[model samples]
Target: MKNGIEIMNVEQTFNGKKVLNGINVKIEKGEIFGLLGPSGAGKTTLIKILTGQLKQTEGKAEILGKDARKLTGEDYKKIGIMMDNFGLYERLSCFDNLKLFAKIYEITDDEISGILKEVGLLEAKKALAMNLSKGMRNRLQLARVLMLKPNILFLDEPTSGLDPATVDAIHGLIENERQKGTTIFLTTHNMAEAEKLCDNVALLNEGKIVEYGNPKELCRKYNHQKKIKLHLYDGQNIELEHDKSVAKILNRYFEQGLVETIHSTEPDLELVFMELTGRKLDK
Candidate 1:
């Protein structure tokens, strides 16, 4: 579990106001690490510092074993970024826009075609950027990021404001990249999305990490009730608390072979977060 990204007591300030407060995190190589928080939780600011787009006022950030503040142009080539507003030439056709980025990266036409096909945008390659649907536009942005075959990807709310199907499509693409061994740094308030894509997650609140771990582990950690609902094959159900008495009853039921389904009353990520942070999701 080598460290791919590390933030060591990182702090940031803007206009004399503190934005991040002693944040510490470590993401292993080839892991989909999620920074989950509501808007204004300093997730984006931290990401910018990690990407070398902004320098932190205090502390350090390390990416791929290189100090983020000292990252060179070649290091930038190994990482791709898709922020809330990934650039695209609205007046240009999809192909032309890709051509411009390809030229910047010194990629060939054949490579561009391959990227287009990978993102399912080959048929609409010649379509004007303004003419493509929102989903198509997202795919086009993804295609541009793929030109460098980036080893690490930073995605900020990649599926925000899209329809369900489009979100699923984008998630599928992201999963494909992860399968190919790309380390992903994801910032989003979508808990469900984090649970689906992340191998580990950090709960950011008011510029601090209140919790961090694998999603299921965090959820289980805060499951204080310790109750389970058993649905019997005969259509009867029983609720049992966690204690020696209930354990004996559960074992008896199992011995009688009446159990069909067992539902544990485990708190979900949201509940765990709310319990920890004393807050809920944004709106």
Candidate 2:
């Protein structure tokens, strides 16, 4: 809670329904912290509160020691947010979109082209925003956010609906940003993307954090059993649960020419989600 962005006991209610109940998180500088949750799980609401667009009914959210609810003009200047609903003007060219955001973020022309090229939109600079593909538009949105040269980035579903290639491009850009000392808070339903890019992740269920830790740590914690799978020379597949005996047996099998291929199996994030939350990410 002392470093990066902290949200302590944050709660929110909509009409008579309590959406977020005592939600808390502390994201560190230069770390890609992922908020993993299904749709309608209050991810967007929490993001709104953190960005000062909405007030929490109870508790507090802070960024770099500044109260999230009372963010100053300078605070806005240092944070970049790319949400699902942050619209791009249909009439503007991709370059113009970045140009407008550059003015808003007070960045100079000297840095705009570099940011565009970094996000792979330099080729689409003259294309109308409305004419871009969905993936291209998403990249343009991210490019617009980076125009601020912000220290902290709040991204909601950054790779949603993008093709595998576009997703790779976006992930590379995100890694590049983190390397440059940008703190990223990402909310996504894409568990694979989260596992690949996040340094730490929190599983949010019904607006509360059900679990939080490094992805590998969580996987090890939840996986009560491990299996060793092997392909035999006779084209038969064999599986043995991991144990001291299994290890010895596998070594002997390999030496006896009985093993062709082998792999160890542990529960993945999706399996862990079902074990912990009793539901799939898409559900």
Give TM per candidate: 0.90, 0.95
Model 1's lDDT to the true fold? 0.88
Would you list the C-alpha lDDT of every candidate in the order shown?
0.88, 0.87
RMSD to the true structure for each prediction, in A, is 2.4, 1.6
lDDT of candidate 2 over 1-283, digit per residue (tens): 4437998999999997888999878888888999998988889999999999999999999987788999888888888899989999999998888888778766777688888888898888989999999889899999887878788999999888889999999999899898898999999988888889899998888888888999888888886778888999899998898887897888889789888899777777778888888988767
> After superposition, which runs of candidate 2 have C-alpha atoms over 4 Å from their true positions?
1-3, 257-260
After superposing candidate 1 on the true structure, give the runs of residues whose Cα lies further than 4 Å from its correct spot.
1-3, 231-237, 244-261
Q: Compared to the true structure, candidate 2 yields what TM-score? A: 0.95
- Superposed Cα deviation of residue 87, candidate 1 (Å): 2.2
Q: For residues 218-247, could you state the per-residue lDDT of candidate 1 as single tens digits?
A: 888988999989999999988899777987
Weakest ten-residue segment in model 2 by summed lDDT = 101-110
